[model samples]
Target: MDVLCESAPNDDDCGTRYSSSSSEDDERRDQGVAMTYMTLDSILNDNSRMFEFLRSFGVLANKYVCATCRKPMSCVKVATTRCGDGLMWRCAKDKVWRSVRKGTWFEKSKIKLKSIVLLTYCFCMRKSVQSTCRITGLSDKTVVDWFLSCREICSALMKKRGKIGGPGVVVEFGESSFGSNKYDKGRWMAEVWVWGAVVCGKDHGELVLNVVEKRDARTLQWFIEEHVENGTVIYSDKWDSYEDAEEFDLQSFAADHNYQFRNKVTGTMERYWKEVKRVLEGGKRRRSGLQSHLDEYIWRESVFVHGCAFHSFMQSVGALYVPRVED
Candidate 1:
């Protein structure tokens, strides 16, 4: 049973291709196991191996302490299955027993660890909700909730990534609206504004995206100060909202969008805005969850540029979500 330790991949590792590209990925998964995006049935018959595989990835604890007995728990192969996996954590003296999933990320989830893993892969691949439901045999509500849970994890990580666009970095600002049209009259029943700033270059740089209540001067300047570093070379359309950009130590350039949509100077940010808005429009997420989805988008966008999307995301999950055996 070999674990995948591929690091710093290239074109093949981006998005779902990392796990679904070839049989080598499945062989590296564990044993003669064949794990892919569409199906995980090959790994189902061996629960004990599945348990150890997850343990190797920090998804489960390799060593556990019994909370009730205050003693060490040993992984023992059991004959019967009550914990869904035929493995149990047994304590020596008091005969205290705990499920293998106790105090792990999969602790409260009724779904199996394998399924959760696949769900995460699908989510990273940007698979649709219906697609995930079909692949994982999970209810629609369960899939939606899990999708949000994944985004919350991304949002937490994004908050820790610090600010984007430092001195000498080319940063661009933009805004777009998304909402339901009223009675097919092309009138927005509700208006939601998405504000974003992206670092521009041939190499993919960082991004800052959020839902803002207003796009006034105070609002735009505030977002720039909060998310972008001082002395960044920034560009945007000639909007009154950004009239005071130079007041904050930023060198600002404004393109006239009426005559020219994307001048060569502002091309990168214009393309980024379209890509983001396209994905956001494709989904049917509620208005309240838009911020989290935006967080997910920016996180994925940045990571996708580096390749190894799924592996990196799983590493983040292990780092951010620590298990509590004492509880």
Candidate 2:
């Protein structure tokens, strides 16, 4: 909710890149099984192109209805103004004026729309913060803040959607620890435990990454019951905590890493941890924001099967901001 910039800059200085036919190209490029880097020219040619694209996906609303009078409002700004760049609207009933970005993620945001959109693309792409900062010409703090916000939206949506694996599905379960032993003897020592699972698919799969307090049987059981579906084939290493998984109506299988009959599903999750740590640069000083990093990793993994990760994420933004019963 906080704007990470000192002041919002004009469109030309925002470093937004786009091509005239880039939207069509995006549609075509996104059809691949793996996500590829989009050229800046292929991303957005003009400022309004991104706005129009969001609208086409129903991420942005068709009408700007007034909140005060509940009537469809008409634009009060000049025809040439960007829709999201502080354009004004006039209520049909009360004749009151309102800023277009009054209540959305763009509200109180001091970053350009194009930069925001590009930052989102970079996040979905799982690019490093330093890399994204260089590309967008944004401060490291600003880009990190924006990436965390997007992760918040992804986390909220994942929670709303509930558990992943179901009947006949193999859900790999694992517990891992992060942080170095050099700090272990000092007051700065931090032991971070992360419990995670993956619903393995042939090409791409969904994952659940949770930061838990303890790695005990009680804790693991509670996490599994809360986040995994009933009758799922839960696979894991021979950890003592997972020994009682069958007590919870799940098909539990345990194996040792040295054994030939190791579970492939759990293997994938191990590789995932490597990729996650690699992207976060070993996640050394990010103890406080570990969950956000996990959320970003999970969300990025979920999008590999789909062509347009950015568009899918944009569609999620509307529901992410909507007031939910749980919230």
Candidate 3:
């Protein structure tokens, strides 16, 4: 929640892009599958458009009920204002004033709505904080905090998506250590071990990557039980900790790394481990923030693999911030 959105500067720069029906189609491919791609330049150049974009998706509140009036408020533009967009929620009945962003995800933000959208886009693209700062004119701290918020969003999404693989599903899993004594700001850091798994034989399988204190049976079993469903076909290396996998009613298979990384009968987790290591190694953060990066990596693989990264992420923003009506 360390959001640092700076207020938008151009108060009168509202555009009519939101009025166009075709604007929502930007994140789609001709084949109907989502392929969210929007340029930073395109987002940075507009303030009102981003507000409208978020409004279209309900990330920003569409309407408000006045506390005093107890009726719906109209979004009216003030003649002179500096709080990002010029609009505010106004109730004609009681002369009560409210922010259009009130009670929404953007309520506490100090930056333009467009910048928030741009930040999510940058996160989706895996852009560095420095480069994102240059592109979005956001401070490093702001970018870092927003990126962390994005990671938190990823973690929440993962929990909501629930565990991966089920009965009759093949799951590939492994354990690996991440650390570098060679150079981490010229100091040695502790090794961080992570247990990772994926739905095998699929380009975009369900995933689970968790940082563990140790790789013992009790420790690994805790995460394994949490992240994976029972009755899954679990493939792994010959790690003794997984001896009790069947105790949880799981179907377990082991590969002997001494002979080969993979064999027709046993090994399937080699490629999955390679992908996880590749992502973890690509990060520039310290061991402390490794879990965030790993969570974000798993989230991206879960979402972006469907070719709907930015769009899907924005929808998640809407779902989280928008109040739902109970049936």
Best by lDDT: 1
Rate residue 28 of model 2 by lDDT.
38
Task: Work out the TM-score per prediction.
Answer: 0.76, 0.71, 0.77
Model 2 Cα lDDT, one tens digit per residue, 268-292: 7787778777876675544778887
Error of 1 at 86 (Å): 3.4
Q: Locate the minimum summed-lDDT window of 10 residues in model 3.
A: 254-263
Every candidate's lDDT: 0.65, 0.62, 0.64
Candidate 1's displacement at residue 143, Å, is 1.4
Q: Locate the minimum summed-lDDT window of 10 residues in model 1.
A: 254-263
Ranking by lDDT: 1, 3, 2
Best by TM-score: 3
Q: Which segments of model 2 are wrong by more than 4 Å? A: 1-50, 66-71, 79-86, 91-95, 181-189, 239-266, 322-327
lDDT of 3 by residue, 1-327 (tens): 011122433445454344322333632432232423444345444545655666767776766777775677766655335455556666677887776677778778887666777787777767789988987899999999999999988877877878877776777777767774455557766677777878877766677877888676667657766777766666665444445644532233222211112212234456656766676563334777888778887777676546557667878888876742111
The TM-score ranking, best first, is 3, 1, 2
**Candidate 1, number of clashes:** 0
Answer with 1 or 3, whichever has the higher TM-score.
3
What is candidate 3's TM-score against the reference?
A: 0.77
